[model samples]
Target chain A: MRLRLTPRDPSYFDLFAAQASYLVVGANLLAEILGADRATRKDINRRMAEAEHAADDATHTIMRRLNQTFVTPFDRDDIYNLASSLDDCMDFMDEAADLIVLYKVDELPARVSDQVQVLQRAAELTAEAMPRLRSMDSLQEYWVEVNRLENQADKTHRKLLAQMFDEITDPILLLKLKEIVEKLEDAADAFEKVANSIETIALKES
Target chain B: MRLRLTPRDPSYFDLFAAQASYLVVGANLLAEILGADRATRKDINRRMAEAEHAADDATHTIMRRLNQTFVTPFDRDDIYNLASSLDDCMDFMDEAADLIVLYKVDELPARVSDQVQVLQRAAELTAEAMPRLRSMDSLQEYWVEVNRLENQADKTHRKLLAQMFDEITDPILLLKLKEIVEKLEDAADAFEKVANSIETIALKES
Candidate 1:
């Protein structure tokens, strides 16, 4: 029996992972932005906005690769979906930060900060997992860890929301906190989607 | 150049569309379940719970088609992304309804109901647009209409959320309402994703 490998060139998956890594950096920046005091809202949100643009650029490169290339290091659909999934994660982060700026939130909620930390961790795990995708032997192990991180993030998201409802007395603050928590949850879900896509790639490879 | 006049089989797209239509029906059922009397919670939520199984079935069929078929009616990546987007919409709706059942909300907020209706309309447009993918020329108008409907749904979602924050008094109720509205907004976003995918297909044909 002969094993066939997908022909590779510019390494879309690698570029995609770099973008995912940038998203994590953006998440960290957002965390810092939220924690920072009395800074201009524009300055705080800039990192997140740039992250969104970077993700989009990666997605555009992915589309071009899919169109012009005959072979990929991964499945064509997987490449596109993974790019979009990472983009979705950044999109949520950017949206959450944008909301904070738009609403002129004075103080960052501790719960939101915790969820962002989890998201940063998850994004880092995702970036780590991407290179191993080229080799089928290690895909399962990375995906399991990714899935575990996502589950942990989900638990944090639920707990944060529950606490937000319990402790927050102001209606506007409650709404803002809930939005931030849910945005974090959505971003976590996006990460999970990438993990699931990786699972599919594993299935395809195996 | 001779146009490829061969009519590819519609069974795949047809089945896919039918399942999406069922999901919309399920969304309506959820709206009804959420709005039902407390006495009916057990029965209505149970039925809504069952929709997950049905959605899974639809998803399985779509995935199978994606795996086995090479020349899809549309771009393979678009088909895959659109399928997952539809599934996500159903999943979010199901998750929100499950939350309602678990939280034991006695009465439905009018805003949640309004958002659900918008989602239903968007889903209907999706089901309508699916068959047109088989013959892009025939569905050009529908594609445009679906995009317009998505725009309408987006406006409704934003306006509804604004009103939700403006009118709701209790912090707890405000949290629940925000979650429900956000879930519905996501459903609308999923529909818009599909609409955008179709427009991309239309562009290819034109």
Candidate 2:
């Protein structure tokens, strides 16, 4: 029997890259929120919300294209997973920022900034790697490095939690800080998930 | 153009229901852990881990079948998402149990049990709904009710947080309890996600 194959559309890669770029914007916004004074947090949060919305649109575009195109660059499931994972990263980041504003957290441990830094590096790596998905080449390092970064974030998370319990006295303040830190840690975890989805696609195609 | 259709396999629905069954076991195990004394905590956690492993196996079977089968009951992405979301619910439950063990949390607030009850009900609803996915009929109520249960879980989560800050004086204990509660909340959230995936599939297929 003869097999029929539809022509591949490369625009999916563009959309993926665009979505990853939103993660970068989101990471930067998170880092900024960590450093910004209380006076600026509201504005920073608004910007983060905007970034999250932009990422959502990018995800919708990918999904819409998947429905319209008979053939995708990779498995349709991989595309959907990648898009959702990227969206999750932004969502957690936005949630973290919102928590800070909602909780009116005045001070954060330095380790929170450290976690955001890990997120920034992972976001950069993700943005760089999304375009490489078209060929599925040199993408293994992207995921491996992301896994390492997530591990680093995990260590920082544990240390921060331990320190908070050991040093923090006020239960209310501890609650606020803990929620923010966990969300940042979750963002890091979401980034690793995105990388894992990309790696899965690579393995399946290769 | 002539469209060729492949027959849908019903085994997938079986696997999904089996996975949901593990969730029921897990929810009960979580409730047991919450109510059990320290002496039985280890045993309960072990049981939870086992349930999680079983759910993982079910998820793997679904994925393997998805790779081998040409036609599925619904979109392949929806199948994968539903399976993963169910697996995630178990993972979070296991994590919460493990956290209780790891933190050696002496006593939990009564509301923790309330959250687990919501999870139990949602799990039951999910198990009942997975079989109906084959026909995509009467599944709407399953997801809508799950969403309501998740909202209920959210209120309990916030109330527990408030109580932790208000009544719990020890910073260390508060931190431990908060993490466990959040994980439980996350499990509830994952269940709703599974329901949402099912609902999406139902809408698309109908």
Give the per-residue lDDT digits (tens) of candidate 2, residues A56-142.
877887889888889887888778888899999999999999999999898889989999999999999999998788777799899
Give the true-structure RMSD of model 2.
9.6
- Using all chains and alpha carbons, the TM-scores for the candidates as numbered come to 0.63, 0.63
After superposition, which runs of candidate 1 have C-alpha atoms over 4 Å from their true positions?
A1-10, A27-77, A94-110, A200-206, B1-32, B35-50, B68-82, B85-89, B95-105, B109-206
Model 2: CAPRI class: incorrect
Q: Which ten residues in a row have the lowest lDDT in candidate 1 chain A?
A: A1-10
Interface DockQ of each model:
0.15, 0.14
Measured with C-alpha atoms, the lDDT of residue B153 in candidate 1 is: 68
Q: Which stretches of candidate 2 lie over 4 Å from their true place?
A: A1-10, A18-81, A94-107, A138-141, A144-159, A162-166, A199-206, B1-18, B36-54, B64-69, B73-78, B98-104, B109-206
Compute the lDDT of residue A169 as modeled in candidate 1.
Answer: 78
TM-score for candidate 2, please give it. Answer: 0.63
Q: Give the fraction of reference interface contacts each candidate recovers.
A: 0.14, 0.14
Clashes (backbone N, CA, C under 3 Å), per candidate, total 0, 0
